[model samples]
Target: MDRTFTEHLLQWYDANRRDLPWRSNPEPYGVWISEIMAQQTQMERVVAYWRRWMERYPDLGSLAAASEEEVLKVWEGLGYYSRAKNIRKAAELILTDHAGVFPDEIKQIQALPGIGAYTAGAIASIAFNKVAPAVDANVLRVFARLLDIAEPVKAAKVKQEVEQAVLPLIPEKRPGDFNQALMEFGAMICSKRPDCDQCPMSQHCAAFANGTTGERPVLPRKRKAIHIEMATGVLVYNDKVLIQKRKPDDVWPGLWEFPGGCVEKGETPREALVREYMEEVELEIYPAEKITVVSYSYTKYRVTMHCYLCHSANNGQLKPVFNEAVTGQFVSPESLSSYAFPAGHRRLIECMLDEAWFDNLK
Candidate 1:
């Protein structure tokens, strides 16, 4: 472990640290929220969401007691709905078993839902002032570059090696600040395309000396995108549009929105819509011209939605084709203001409705 490197990085962080909302007082609840929001998410976007989340559920108690639907709504556009669910579960556990007090011990914190080694270490150190090593992407990158390690960071063995290497360097006096300073340095100076000249550790960094700063922490290969096609019907009758409630176990579970399905290989968008509508909603649809398309992005995949206007030929007899949709209903376009749609669907509906498509139907 390089003692000088640690001191230099910490000094640089103290002088150049960004004034982020979560770092205000290092509250356990606030730190926990920020860490969760940052998992597989960027810092810039997490800032706004973190501020809004704190405003709504400032403490663990408020979040623990809130309904899942409400929590999902708050985390609507964020994607990875399971993170929000696990957060609630952790809060509930803290409220029930721990009496709403966050556990200070690393093992006890790690036992909570959604919390792993890094998260537990972070909470235990930064918030509870305990001696723990929090190794995340930034820490991994910093250490990998410092040691000139070429192993892919995703490999369990490589990650373990990196943790072992950096664990000895954590200052006994303030492990929390040490961890944050390293992470901040990796974020600002020793970035993916590192600026060696600006990095405080460049003087002794192994990767810098070897001229392989960008190549030390090799990342794993990315998976190919999964293509899914859904034929959908923007089923309309009179002034009302059709919607169905998703099953509690399904993705975007319990949310309400339009009818559609994956477009099969060689199937047209309208045909897929007809098949999906019949299979999922148990109704026949005559899809009109394309109305709108909504593109939603996530860490591993992206969905491009193509919606079309249609009239229900079956009139009143409608049953959900798949068990995931428990029930179906029709709401007037003007009256849809009261119903809650999935965030993506809401955006698509707004786009279609704003163009006066519903008005022309009358």
Candidate 2:
């Protein structure tokens, strides 16, 4: 345990931590939510979502009582759907086993659905006032530069080494502040393109001293961007709407969405939709209004959705659009309440329902 490092970092934190709401109380639930929101998302964006979420679901008891669809709706556009799922599961576990109180012990906290070692350490240190090591990406970056370690810090196995190195350095009286200081230091000073001139640790930072500020702790390369061109049909007959269910084997399994297909390299969105319709549903559609365009990102790929309001030229027959979707039906606006639509579909639906005054307002 390097007492000097811990003290030095915490001293800097006293003047420089960000003004975030979650930092006010060190509540376990608040910290947990912040940590989850911070994953694969920008801190600025997470701040808004976090504030709204805490207001919506104040505690585990309230979260466990909410429906799955409602929870997912609240978590829409955040991506990484599993984080919301695990959070709900953890809420249920807390209600059933822990009697609604969040567990304070490191092992118990780690045993929760979404809580890992870093999360466990965070909750314990920040909420319970324990001296647990909180090691995350920021901490790893900071420590890697400080120790001049050049290995790829993201190698899953290196987590233990990072945790061990910080374990002994945690301050005894204010471990939570110490952990936050290290994270803040990494975020503000020892960043990817760090400003060593303004850093408190620049004098002691091994990487800065050796002029290897940008070289140590090499991160793994990012995956190639997945390209997709999808065609979505906004079918309207009378005042009703048309939507289909995505089968369990489908990419967006169990979600309700407009009928569409991915476009090939040479084909346009409209052409792809027509081709997919013939192949999947054995139905022909005459395009009417090209309504709007939307986009969303999944784990491995991104989607560009071209929505077209279409009508059957001859009121033609409709059938399953591919083996992945077995049902294609028209629905009253009221029926929307019974279905769980994908986030993008729901947004599109809202726009469709608001079409009358949308132009006037625009």
TM-score of each: 0.91, 0.86
Runs of candidate 2 with Cα error greater than 4 angstroms are: 245-255, 278-283, 313-362
- The residue-by-residue lDDT of candidate 1 on 240-290, one tens digit each, is 678887887877776777888677788888888887877776678788678
Task: Indicate the TM-score of model 2.
Answer: 0.86
What digit string (tens of lDDT, one per residue) describes model 2 on residues 1-362? 35776677777889889998899987999999998888878889899999889999998888999886677767776766668878999999998999889998999999999889888998899888899999989989987888787788888667778888888888778888888888778778787888788888777788888888788777889898897778888666665667777775666555667777888888888888887767665667766777788787777678888888776654544444454485768787767766767767777777766775123210
lDDT of 2 at 22: 92
**Model 1 worst lDDT run, 10 consecutive residues:** 315-324
Judging by lDDT against the true structure, name the best candidate: 1
